[model samples]
Target: METQALDFPKIHAVLRTNGTGEVTINGTSHPIQADDEAAVLREALRLITDTAAHLGRPVKVTTTDPDGQGLIVVSPEGHVSEAAPAKTAPRRQKAPAAAPLITSVPEAVPAPAEQPAATVAAPVQTTPTPAHEPDEAKQPVTFASSVDQSQSPPTAAPEQSTRRSLKETSFLVSAPVLEPAAHGWRGILTKLGFRMEPSAEELTEREDIRTVSQHWPGPRTVAVVNRKGGANKTPTVVMLSAILARYSGAATVAWDNNESQGTLGWRTEQGGHNNSVLDLIDSSQTLLSPSTNAAEIARFVHHQTSDKFDVLRSDENEEGDHEVTAEEVDIAHQVLTRYYRLIVMDSGNTARSANWRQMIHHTNQLVVPVTAIEDRAEAARLTLQTLESRGGHDAELARNAVVIVSESTDSKRSMSGDALKRAKAEAQRIADGFAPHVRAVVRIPYDPALVNGPIRYEALQPATQRAWLAAAAAVAKGF
Candidate 1:
């Protein structure tokens, strides 16, 4: 190509290694291999060029072979011509004159001559001045021009400007403009006093606020745990992460704390297995340091569908029983607390582990997924009892813990008449037993697609998904 001055700050260099050597860009891992180096460099260059062009700048490139040297030039302006085109400056113009004022007057009456002295003598009158008098002969005098004399024509007043300004000042001194919609039936009861019931739009807006409140991080860390397989914990974690991402727009991590092979990583479709929480803990132990930089740890994790969510994969090796330790979990909490607005621990079932209990202790909310089955209800109750026995009796834990019944097909769990009745009774018992401490007992109906793979939020059947989103909303409300 023709030579031209580069107009961008810098052009990225793609280092290609012959074998398994690591590639570093600006002292950071390149995150790609030699086989893909050309393509990566091309893509990076394309992005840089597009950005420079958008900013009216230029980016240039240089290449080299196996050895350590090459030259590349970039310009802050993307001009390629030998001589940059001269920019034609804009010219100023005079402002137009204001519109003229017009006033109307009634016709004047002629003066009546005096009939006095019975002789109606000719009225003495002064001679009028000639129209063509010379300047020197005429008296030098000035009169206000009609253009300046007439008061500006009355302007129509704006209707609400004054009222709006008053309202704005009152708001500044007294209250915010966008206050929360009133709550409960009292709002409906007091409609005559301007305490009207929230409109549909207002209710929708309140729901959004509630959703935001649920996911924001506070003083406590929360983990959603279920030890049983096929409990929908992974999907729950993913959806929760998506919601948190949508709300916070800050760093949020979904940790696949399950040491055993799990689906958290698979759901996000990220491939690397070399770096995970397990690796981090192991590296920390070997280094003998308290590592708490989230960006550093984040470099090893995978990004989920949303930019806000990151994933820490489970151990890939099937036979590996390596579990998260109490110390490691604490370290993770300390590190995560500094960087993330919300950290979602997808700790798969295996509540028997000491580490799992520690995870629960660190969390602000513990979501336990139960199916609407007799056995599942019994198991859920037993799990609650276990939590109570393990020192989860504090008001915070009691109030924050939730048991969600999953896979409800027809609002009932079992086919047998007696079993169905028992299931309903069990649900009520669970709700009643956990009352005051537990916020609500919710249900998630059976959706076959969830088991197979991730589904789009919009594609889910409205009835089932709406209930799920409502449950999510409830979860958010508790937080």
Candidate 2:
């Protein structure tokens, strides 16, 4: 077994952005920089500590040596360690970029809105091998991503690559030594160096980074459904669209499939053109014409300028009394499907609507989103029940669905641990039933920024971005 441990050196961990790309901490702004993962990791821990304090929670982020090289840990009941920096700093040299790396994550379960908001998934288990352990047991497992060359980063391996090639062949080989940075925020008073055992928060952050970096081939449809929709569906569409577009950089679209007035356009950025799905339906003949192209079709859909997905909004005018028909939806869907790799539909409240049912029927993967509220959760349950009872393909769609339980956008303001845990349990109970019938279950914690109007992935806190990234990764598996 080759060693999986590589000296990370002084790395800078940036708070991942959704729409915008900056991470700020302790009222001081930090731009995403080109430093190693360690510095960024230290900063990330600082961000977590800051967020917990802002939420008026007792969670604390502590390091063994406040001024020495040590490890950082966060705990609600004060079970964290603190350390000081090394008195005589060890001289280190920069090593060459390590070999291409890939990670596999267990499906993550996000804590409910009220659980001190610790992390994404469990931390990458880095418990050191005991001195007496056999060497062969140390070899790690590897897997490849399925995205094409264009979508793959420079470091990503080809799809046909195997774990054997990914394994480290030289356990004792020498590499250039990299000196840890001695200045800047990485040299903060509370600097905690690296440790063999990582905190759970650190593990979740590492997993989120790997998840967001992956890419996959796709031309898939994701429906965010909740029959009792008042405001949830549009955000789900926007968030999923943003995260997917952010990570994959693939062409993605979000269509507001509301029968009547829908708020998707209002919540997202609107284009200069007042064109809606109606315009697309009227122009489908030309758009779908054999000679037509992707750029040409962009004229009808609303493009979310910041996040890279298009929006086919429903008619939002109060005076407009038009209800979309099933045939029109098929026309619009076909047109979008031709040009975009992913389409996320924000549906109306009617489960019986022709377009709504059609969405479920044609959906590649269904995403049933519910808030902690009872009525909202019930609506999600009923929608799944309706599909299960309907049989045939609908049952299959229900079976392969991804259930998402989210905190209300404004949930943080009134959150209490006991109340939050109860809400999470309820949401999990709903998710538990579908566990047998679904592909994945994702939970999203509350983010105040997403509650208002437009969502800027950049403006969200680190924790918010982590949650979204984790949820999006689960959905991307279906792709």
Candidate 3:
């Protein structure tokens, strides 16, 4: 066996093995066993090929064997030649000098960057020869013609095509001159996007109304409230608490203000608690003694769902167990604000109740759920009236107070065309009556799912039920 050295400009050697039976690259040896020789040869050829490619230069490998068979080829420009001969004649040749010629030509001649004076003059002073002359003589004539054609000014075909397209588009868009009546109709049609008629329901719902409230820093303390019972206020509070817990992952406290009945805790599965809101109110005298630590007062609050929310249950036996003096309510509110990011109170419908007044005053939002029936409408009106009386009439509160119409049937049972019309008229009258006093009045259509007590956020109808969640989000935005 003989050894031969090959130069590869691009690839650098990473490893090599002993050259006895097998040679390795950078200590990675391969035995010349069975078909291993072919693999080694292939790897070596690949290395040279890659090296040539990287260096941008060609390489040639040859073995000293008598067969001249183990030969690898690479091009000077880093290209591999699989079949081409390794040695070939040179391709470059020197140009011969020629006499200068000049001739008349058009504008826009592209002069060479460093053309000699002789070359520049040759094109300008070319002699005009006959086109039908011998091949050798016609060559110069053809060259001169090509030079002249290249220098000639370009025709404006592109500009003409563009102008034609613009003219065609303008013609298609142009309206015919019309009579006064026809022109007016056409203008109206155009303004209405050519729709002859649009849905009345769509038109009425087109006006997008958004809720606005004062931005309160720290935890978003929302009160789930409605003056009237069966308005799904308790269910709304439960679902809102779950949604708030799911969204914020922060601890929330659901205060059961239904003193007459522990409905909130019962519905939420947090019943059988002795230290209810009444207990807190009874103990407020000692708890709110200016000397009592606010943090300690917060500890009396019981957790309903571990880290999620704390439940403040009301006494079921006592008639007015949740009732508290104004001072206790004020102190409790201050302590709650310090401990919680949110405080959702399930308020009763009685407008005369102290809890109702306190909740309306301290709440960031007053969610008033009403039924489509006349009685529920009256209750909603009263609830709104009570809130306005307590908080003072303001545009923001009026607009932010969500009047959700619960227990509505999708089959038009209660929302018949006449009933809907009446409801609309009543809603308008209510809105108009409280104009400038109520900020906004939104109607949440009744969802059947809410009838089965409190439902999760995901269970509610996405289109209609979202009004409540949107209202909650709007209320949260204040924080």
Expressed as tens digits, the lDDT of each residue in 254-336 for candidate 3 is: 77665366477666544334566666766766775677775564445655443255677666664554455556556666656
Residue 255 of candidate 3: its Cα lDDT?
A: 74
What TM-scores do the predictions have?
0.51, 0.58, 0.44
Which portions of model 3 show Cα errors greater than 4 Å? 1-216, 271-274, 281-307, 318-322, 389-400, 407-437, 440-445, 461-465
Residues 365-385 of candidate 2 have per-residue lDDT tens digits of: 788887767788778878988
Which residue segments of model 1 deviate by more than 4 Å? 1-205, 213-220, 271-274, 283-294, 392-396, 409-437
Kindly report the root-mean-square deviation of model 3 from the true structure over all alpha carbons. Answer: 28.1
| Model 3 weakest 10-residue run by lDDT | 115-124
Tens digit of per-residue lDDT, candidate 1, span 361-457? 6777777666655565556556666676666343356456776765443423325666556656665665565555566667665555455554445
Candidates ranked by TM-score: 2, 1, 3
Predicted structure 1, TM vs. truth: 0.51
For model 1, what is the alpha-carbon lDDT of residue 368? 68
Question: How much is 417 displaced in model 2, in angstroms?
Answer: 7.1
Best by TM-score: 2
CA lDDT of every candidate = 0.51, 0.60, 0.47
